[model samples]
Target chain A: MSRLNEAEIRRIAELAVKQLEGQATAANVEKVVHEAVQRMSGEGAATAARHERMKNVPPHNQAKGQRIILTAFGANSIGILAGLTSELAALKCDIVDLSQKIMQDFFTIMILVDAGNSDVAYEQIRERMARVGESFNLKVIVQHEDIFKTMHRV
Target chain B: MRIELPEILETIRMTEVEHFDIRTVTMGINLKDCISDSLPRLKNNIYEKLMRTAAEHVATAEKVEAQYGISIANKRISVTPVALVGDGYYAEDFVEIAEVLDKAADNLGVDYLGGFSALVQKGFSKGDLSLIRAIPEALTSTRHVCASVNVATTKAGINMDAVYLMGKIIKQTAEKSADNDGIGCAKLVVFANAPEDNPFIAGAFHGVSEPDVVVNVGISGPGVILRAVKEARNADFPTLADHIRRMAFKITRAGEFVGRKVAELQNIPYGIVDISLAPTPMPGDSIADILKAMGLQDVGAPGTTAALALLNDAVKRGGLMASSHVGGMSGAFIPVSEDQGMISAARAGHITLEKMEAMTSVCSVGIDMVAVPGDTSAESIAGLIADECAIGVSNSKTTAVRVIPVPGKTVGEEADYGGLLGIAPIMPLSKIDNSHFIHRGGRIPAPVKGINN
Candidate 1:
């Protein structure tokens, strides 16, 4: 793009100050004019340029969580509108398949994990699950894939 | 140690163990060939079949449980509807055969033997006729044998004659077993759409299509589900729904795991998982406890129906989301003798048979563990079973009755079956009788105009 010369920048600054004259007092207009010149000449707004450049970065840097299947009581308790996949993303857990049903209560969730950088422990996962149950008034349980399918009929 | 309160500690003990258990190991042996003209030969064949089936069943079931470190609450068997097998055999001969079965179960170390049943949904076969006729004597004569009659089922309307006969037979059966806590009646169940693969008794039957043998899992957890629901009640509706869904998923998963393992160890095909909230006669093991925790004084309180409906819906919803194959009566149970809260409610005059029947509309089975007065006619028992079956047929759902008539035990007297068949204090029934109509001996026609197709 063609750059504005010093003379043009000066005229632009003058016009900007003239338009703001009725809305501001003399000292305010002079302060505004001084700030306008810095922006127009690219002396400020470096972060805005950097943001625009980073907008074109690769997709790998913006990946999200995965989804899996959870099985439990009465009937399919998975919500139709959201589906488990979306909920898994919301909760940052990867889900796989519906596994088993137990004594008219308790659901088993099966998930695939990267476990790359999670700070949470397996016990913590169970505690968070207990909290989930308390919050939703449900009995949510998690099991590894082997244990789930081992007890399940094909 | 800061010890917990006594009652609470007792509740925990009951949840863990208190001699309440898998009451019987019933091996359902098919008796198709035990129909000889000579009563002696028929009896011998029946004994041989039951002995063969029960022995292997006990050994295999015990071995499987030991191998997997999982509990097989009851190691029982069910056979084809008895009437089908005893075709052309005299009713007297059938009684001899039933006696043989009792002996076989005793000899085989099995507690109870089920499948002395007849399926007369559409029309009674000649054998069905004889078996139904001999029910009272057959049950009364045996110590370990159990019998059930399917008089009505979906697609088949009620049979008034069978209904009436069942009532009379139940009375007779009660009279015969009077000294034994009317134990004969304890072994009977009137069913509609009975599953052929249920692992539980006194109504389980092995269907025709089943492999010569197969394994079914009956996992129970009134306590587990109640614990989950009680923990979640403080949350909002949506949150509570999610919590129930998650917990149900886990419990069912556990059952599914154990069921498959049992099936594999038995070397049989795995049957569908039945997520019925089977309650125990133990304190914390009651579904009514869960309801009370949900804020009810007793099971039949005003909001009880709503609570049951919510529980049924929530349970099914959660179970379906978790398992692919769901079958049998997959709802909560309310059997009086089988559940402590129910027994207490009946004893305290807080619950009645009518209310229990009403609740069956939302339960896994209808009118289970109900004990009536010994003097009551078989017609009334038939009427009770019929009414319960009618609800199931009309709704196209599974319903059943395991009504016990404790012979010498009065309305307030107790009948103890030891172990899972806990002590049962009788409940009062309406005096309105139906002997005449039930005795009419013809069929109650299938719903004519109700069919849309």
Candidate 2:
């Protein structure tokens, strides 16, 4: 959440204008500026650093960036994962980590999703996931993982 | 996952099953600058200030609730004590101010607005006297306005005159709202050593020293701790305390997260989190139930005070570590009507007024939500408040009285407030005359502890 300095912002704007000189339409200028800002804001760098720091951790536990934990539980049935994953994919969300367990007649699945890349709002994704759960006759809930980190971690 | 399955499931159980939720998100808006000699200009200033600052308070709270999957029970506002903002006004003018606050609260979509208050712990200002006289009328006329008067503190001792005046005020308020079982009294609190940044209603106020605007939160989770204590049934005292502390720590973290998110969204400064284990009328969500889980046969049993002392201490110790900015009444609240176990014990003749008084010495608040017969003399109510003030001043703790003298109700009947105010069975009080003592009202000198500095 660090803010860029004035000098840094001017540098990014200058680079964007110089790169888009030949094809400087409004849309193209906007696209280049957006990408440049995203790259300079540490979204790309922070993700790389986070992955480097989490190299020793298991893939299932290395949830970083803007991620959410989606939990689904109900009677054991087919296609729950398929239905949920398809909806997440259509929404442009990445399934960073997932685990499932079945006990007797009931199944519970927890999925760690990297939602940073999604163009859809988190609220809409939650609504879509809920619809997916309703279609599969399961109870699904999505919550930002920060709550767990705050409670369980130091 | 970095957070194991057990951790995730435990959180879900606490929120979905055990009723762990942020009890309130209160925005404290300082209204000192709105003061004026002209009442209309004053009213306009107060309304515009509150509406402009807190326009999105409820919506921001709801958005955070949705984001975290933990529901916030109440969205409220606490302004500077009205008496301070409208100092030169008379009683009727203060009542008009209350109406404006109520309108602002309704328009903002908040459930309650506090700080219809006066601080008279040492002595009354002209405004304080006026507001005290206006309480019964102001509370009866408004739906969302809550009032409090601080009559005592450790430093200044008990203002016996203010305490006696409050007793009469409580009676008048009861008479005014008699048809609703003296429900107006439920919205009024008399305090000793009241906190300035308290987010809980009926006693919350934006203290004079506070910033222009800030946000405070109250955390409530009796059910979560009750479950933890129940699971550790056979464990000894230290282990029991440990279990309570861990549960308190987790809930405090959640509470702070919610508070900070709401403040962040509104772009306001975040204040303290009052980590009080405030219970609702829900059956399992009772502090008395937690005591029973800690091996008490029932509330008001012989060791009840000891159990409560331990529970309150552990909650404070645990919560203090979880949040750096812990303030307000951060202990186990044992309000009778709002907690079902407390109501049950009172109805069974197990928990009495005397025992509750003793418990408040070791807890956060005092004499909260207890109902009495309509005929209880003002002197008797004053005596009860004086006793609580004595405990608070002597022990250096925050204490309060929210006693309801339910009009036309007797010991065998109950007064129903219906919502979070809950219901209260009429508890018997001593019939002995205390008029001679109460009428000698001037001041009880500050206790020895008050001179510690």
Candidate 3:
């Protein structure tokens, strides 16, 4: 999972507010976005190869926006195709890859992030993110970067 | 390979959860009568018995496993009680017998060997006393050979004498093979009213009623069960029960298939299938994770009993439905020392022996993976063993204890059994001795007096 900067989290909040408006269920959209953004911390995968690759990329690279598609199901239905670029806007977090899948009752969001360490309080953020999921009636679980790597390696 | 989720569910209909696997195929043989005053003759007799019975055990196990597509996780052997066999023997004689047992297991392709045991809860027999004395040497001198000494029971109090001996023996065994990674102690176990027909090794023994050459199995699948649980954590309690019941059914079916096949391959009659959920050192420790998933921070919480009861009951139901014959300690293992997760919880002070015993009430086995102070008296040890056995006998289920007493360690210290059985921090036991009660030797009559089951 990629780490996002405060500005990137703020930008995500602004976009989510703009795109969803009422579609965003929570009264505090920024809190939800920040929480979601914080989840994109260190990329924990099966191997350290990606971390090595992320290290080589210029920290100043700003134009490289990545796309992420997130879907929320279960509690709600939602689909988001997000466009993000150079991690500088994301506090050195480069969105290398992202995917989302939802069935009738379960929602999963997978992301690959190349950013600074994103470890932060997740519970309060999780509450904010819950509103985004509530609007769609989806139970969304965002997995970090390297988790999918080791998860699939098994 | 991806099909519509609903379509897949509809197509399969998830029919009655036919997920079956083999638990274990234990070859139990009587070795007590094999003991002789003459050391060489005793060794020879043991070799003849085990070699003759278990010669084809491995090949047969493989053939059966392949034929059934069910994983037979453990291939093991249990013998007559060591005390019964080594009656009136010296320490050297006991060591000699242990070596023969070890050689027999190795040659037979058995991964784990059991039945280095002494049942002296009520009182020590002539042989029981000798066997108890010989345990430290027997365990230290041999590999793959396991040991157990019962010191107490409900009917009788505790055997402080035996308890003291055991404390010293555990230390000696650990120190003697400290270089072999102290792997010798892992092979041994202690118990109260130890079952003779247990298919699980390091404790299995051939009961007097057992057929001369039958094969039993101890099926283990905590990993498989854990996966099922993780998949259904969000479901409600009843739904979870349904999921668990289905999972258990599949596991038992697999066990029965493997056990039958192994018996066929070995040309012996297929015995019972023990559908026990045994944990390994893997990430998904069935016992620990199951507890965690049940909403407890760890396994020692108050909810532990209810959760364990459900697990044990579901396993038995599923196993009984799958196989006509089911025996052994077929329940969840609470071996604190053996499970890495348990070690973590214990280290964090989230678990205790009392809570462990509480969970044992619901689960099949009793207080496992416990390490005690080296100075604990034999009588006190006997008392503890008796209390555990009383629970088993009164409840009409099997219960046993396998405690390790690390010499020179006080409560809150660590004794590293290492590799598989794992390490145990010395657990505190009440310093009070119950030797006065243990000194009174009288058999607690079997619960079999009832007319109907």
Residue B173 local lDDT, model 3:
66
- Which one is best on lDDT? 2
- The stretch of ten residues in a row with the least summed lDDT in candidate 1 chain B is B1-10
Error of 1 at B278 (Å): 1.5
TM score of chain A per candidate = 0.32, 0.60, 0.32
lDDT of 2 at B184: 96
iRMS values in order, in angstroms?
14.4, 1.4, 14.8
Candidate 1 vs candidate 2, lDDT winner: 2
Per-model TM-score on C-alpha atoms:
0.68, 0.91, 0.65
Ranking, lDDT, top scorer first: 2, 1, 3
lDDT of 3 by residue, B195-300 (tens): 6567875677777677777788776666556666677778876666666776677566656666765777667887787777777555565478776775678877
On a 0 to 1 DockQ scale, where is model 3?
0.01
Could you report the DockQ of all the candidates, in the order they appear? 0.04, 0.47, 0.01
Candidate 1: tens digits of C-alpha lDDT, residues A3-121: 65777677766877687867777777777766666666573357568767766653223222211123222233444213433544445554322333333544333334322133455
Worst 10 residues of 3 chain B by lDDT: B10-19
Query: Could you tell me the TM-score of chain A in candidate 1?
Result: 0.32
Write the residue-wise lDDT of candidate 3 on A1-154 in tens digits.
2545567667766767776668676756656665555554433232367767776776424223222111223532334323222222333344455555555736545444433333333332334444555555554332222211211121
